[model samples]
Target chain A: METPNPNIKMWQGNVACAEGALAAGCRFFAGYPITPSSEIAEVLSLRLPKLGGNFIQMEDEIAAMGATIGASLGGVKAMTATSGPGFSLKQENIGFAAMAEIPCVVVNVQRGGPSTGLPTHAAQGDVMQARWGTHGDHPIIALAPGSVRETYDMTVKAFNLAEKYRTPVILLSDEIVGHLTEKVEVPPIESLGLTDRKKPTVPPEQYRPYEMDSSDIPPMANFGEGYRYHVTGLAHDETGFPTNNPEKIQAQLERLNRKIERYRDEIVEVEVQYTEDAEILVISFGSTARSVRRAVINAREQGIKAGLLRLKTIWPFPGKEIEAISASVRKIIVAEMNLGQLAHEVEWATRRSKPVVRINKINGEPITPNEIFNAIIRQD
Target chain B: MDYLYYLRQDKMPHIWCDGCGHGIILKSILRCVDKLGWDKNDIALVSGIGCSSRTPGYVDFNTLHTTHGRALAFATGLKIANPKLHVIVVSGDGDATAIGGNHFIHAARRNIDITMIIYNNYIYGMTGGQVSPTTPAHKKASTAPYGNPDEPFDISRLAQAAGATYVARSTVYHVGKMDNYIGNALQKTGFSVVEILTPCPTSYGRRNKEGNGVDMMRYQKENTIGIEKAKNMSAEALAGKIVTGVFVDKEQESYLNRYNEVIKKAQSGV
Candidate 1:
């Protein structure tokens, strides 16, 4: 990655993500205004049009998701940003994008939730929602950024993964990191390894929107690309037309999952530090991970053998990594703002081999480093 | 039968029920596009979930069968993404004006260049003739077993009020006018709405004593008034009459044209 702009400049996390989108060749954004996440839309609104791309403030969150998918199908990299309430509204179309295999990014700035719990406040309560928000058995790729720099990096990766897998990728940012300002070295556009969706190798007459003999990811043909094809929410055959045949529909369902699942090693990313000969492994992600990192460092200086595992990829959960690390570790601590969303996943991943401790806080405040540090010292 | 070139023969026969008037509207849409000499690839046909939304399944164009009541929103993005693609959304009465009403009015407000073809059968036919936003007060729907008490919406008037550049209405019986209005709406450079009155014999007609599809067409022919003729009729005399024809027609810069202006101002170092 050509060294991320080569200089440090002060930028808000949302601003950095917006700049990253522009640098990553994202040409379209359709969004609705909501708390915490509105800055992403506001910044993109000003810059996308300048690049001869588009940015539309849609009627609602669902409409924003619809427009994002539509723009992507029209042959452009597209995204939409929203907070909790808006994320809830976009679930239907998010599932539609999953079923129809449209490449787009949805940014959900985590806030206090359930309903309109806390809009402006910081809380990482949307982890479970981000993974299973949309209905049915489907596949999604989500990235969580723990800092301003990672926000830029992950936003670019979100678009790349979405295009690469022909699936909707989520950049699950929380309120604290979303509003946080820090120095980031942004890379130039030419330096980034941007990826686009694969196009058909065959002629338009023989083009199938969802067909691959060996590769799970199918080549996508845009609406106006002289390949007249159908895209539907219903279970569809390889030709992109709705089908009821049990064999074809079963194959279609399996393909949607396998496309991303088979390449889990490449899609999953996590930051592991000091896990060698460690007794207590601390696991966290996004804004909460920042505090956990500090606590882990403080734990190390205090003569306690502690390690930090900060997640960059939330979905296709890093089970293998967690399971492997559990062999040497005496116990694991899963810290998050929510009650037990990712902690549940951690427990399932470790298979109860190591006792797990949860640092949970759902109040409209961040999980402080001292709080996590206390949990680190008190644990026997 | 030359219009058969536009049909995806392999995907047929369509899912529409017997005596359903949706096929008539579908043919008119194909006829209009064919008459315009449009390349099949240039046309993007989008639809929400309904019997009418099923029209896209039979077409050989760039078709999209979207989630219920989201055709216009999706089409808006497609149009904005590439201002050159002809994006046409076919939504049902319930799909467009009920669940999808907000998107409908908003799309018109932007005046984006897209043709919205509404199949107004006055009932939610796909869901077994439930009461829809356009169901007449006295019509019998499944939900309105004893007759609907709520007033119906005038779709053409709604579009005109919401700032759609082209607005027209025609019945399935008025085949020529339906084709003409669809063609006109397709050619317009802003958000255009053409609501065509069709029949739902299986669900609505059986409940409303409106007889079969032929009987419904007969009623439309007898009780409908052209926009020109309705001008002379008093409000009292126009009661119970389906007013048909062009309601709004004018030109303005579409959403894309105005957005291009935004790009100009953004790029300029002023």
Candidate 2:
């Protein structure tokens, strides 16, 4: 008298992330164990070695990021996952990858923090820190997903963007997304398009490590391929040598910054719902987007015309789309776990006195749908 | 021949001041690597931000130019990802032993297979000749124009005490000996540091009235005693003397070797 349910399955967001990384050709995972992100490292530690991939639990977050960069150089798609305090500990190495232009994925399943705010609770306080935590001026590609399915999809995309741009791409998940259990289909690895970093086509003797021919990304070659190039944080010339020449420094700096800026349209990918004729708009990312979606539905039932702009890509700020929406919408409400982080960007993008309301709760807790609805109602 | 052929020459001639000892130390490093005949692909170079940390740009290798005081962290990652590659780090005194002092000690304690080459110019050269942890006491620098009030770091001692498997010190003036010491350190199985006492001729030299690169080299030549002699000397006798030689050489399993043991033990279902 027992019947198995064909459509039912159980998997946590962390497992989905691990499986998605495997699907994305991630043969190397270097991460220290931390919660709620620890499940990712735990599953990866078990699964990676079985598949002939490398999984190393480094001593700390710094070493974790460093190992991922190293494995990427060895021609493997590599990634590392961590939570709040670990993410803060990893900024220096993440910035290193940014400056060196190493292609890799860093998954930060954010918990509350200025410093270790919440280890187990869910919060999105790292929204601003993800963009500006690293020292110096550099571009970052960050993705946030509200659901387990999106975590898998976005983790794959994060790898692709990193490879395409030759920069570190961050997957900004919160504890809610990383630990929430849901059914996810693991696609056959070959069905997905995985990107390996571009190696120089020229002979090792003729290669220029950081010189771009036409594409924004310069051709790169890994170690043991015989090609060699230096990487430095200092402003350098096309050949990647350190320079003090103001003109060369300026050119290098601009190139580093603009390589991502010029491709903003291609870089930014967002999900918009009911925004065409909306008077009030809700902007949110990560797990907060789920609450915003619920709030949008609640606002509609209350006879208020509300829409949701769920940021799938959180960096390069999506200025054009945000600007376009701000011009047409009467009010913009930003819902996040931190006070006035993405709200600052919204204000900057709108330029005008756009009445942008912030629904922030940073006591290691997520903002509920009621909070988002109230914030919108207050603005209304 | 352009000795720096592998260097990103197009980005040069370079930003180092005239008569700076960094150029000389860099040359020695490249020469050692070349002479060893190791494939450039098998070598990984990492550096933190500073005047000497810029050395990674001149060598064609798998390279990472990381944040200030964190080259050790990046190099540790590189070594862990593929322990087969020879990982080396080039850091400034400030970058390696000051701001990044915590990472440096931990790497040594863990005995990771990384070679750290510290360019000790006694001052922060790139940031304009400020006093550094390696700056001798009472020495005048841009930040300490009146005289450095802080005690100087005996870097080799600190590293050895931190559990580094191999540690050595050499000056830019001793190019031949430096190449030998550096080569041996690179060949060592675990964490090693070669504290290259280079001269910041433009800043440190000018401030201290050492005349130029030549004068700085002469000062080093006269002040340094061999490690054997240093071992027998009293603190008063060794007061103005710099010791140049290998201080620690021992065998211990590196990070990777220990990790492999864990993997092996796990595979056996233990």
DockQ values per model:
0.88, 0.39
For candidate 2, lDDT tens digit of each residue in B1-270? 246655656557666888788888778778878878777778888888888887776666777787778778667666766677888899999998888898899899989889999999899999888999999999998889799999998999999999999999999888888988898888888899899898888988888888888888898899988899888999999987779998988898887777676566556666
lDDT per residue for candidate 1 within A1-380, as digits (tens), equals: 56755567788988988988887789899999999999999999899988999999999999999999999999989999998999999999999999999999999998998799999888877777788999998999989999999899889999889999999998999899999999988766666779999998889889888885588888988889899999999999989888889999999899899988999999999999889878888999999888888998999999999899988999989999888876798888899999988889999998887888999999888988898888888845
Pick out the ten consecutive residues of candidate 1 chain A with the lowest summed lDDT. A1-10
Q: What is the C-alpha lDDT of each candidate?
A: 0.90, 0.83
For candidate 1, lDDT tens digit of each residue in B1-270? 496798889877888888889999999998898889988889999999998999998999999999999998899888888777899999999999999999999999999899999999999887888999999898888899888999989999999999999999999999999999999999999899999999888988889888998998899999999999999999999998999999999998999999999999999944
Candidate 1: residue A180 Cα off by (Å): 0.5
**Cα miss at A49, model 1 (Å)?**
1.1
Best by the lDDT measure: 1
Candidates' chain A TM-scores: 0.97, 0.94
Top candidate, metric DockQ: 1
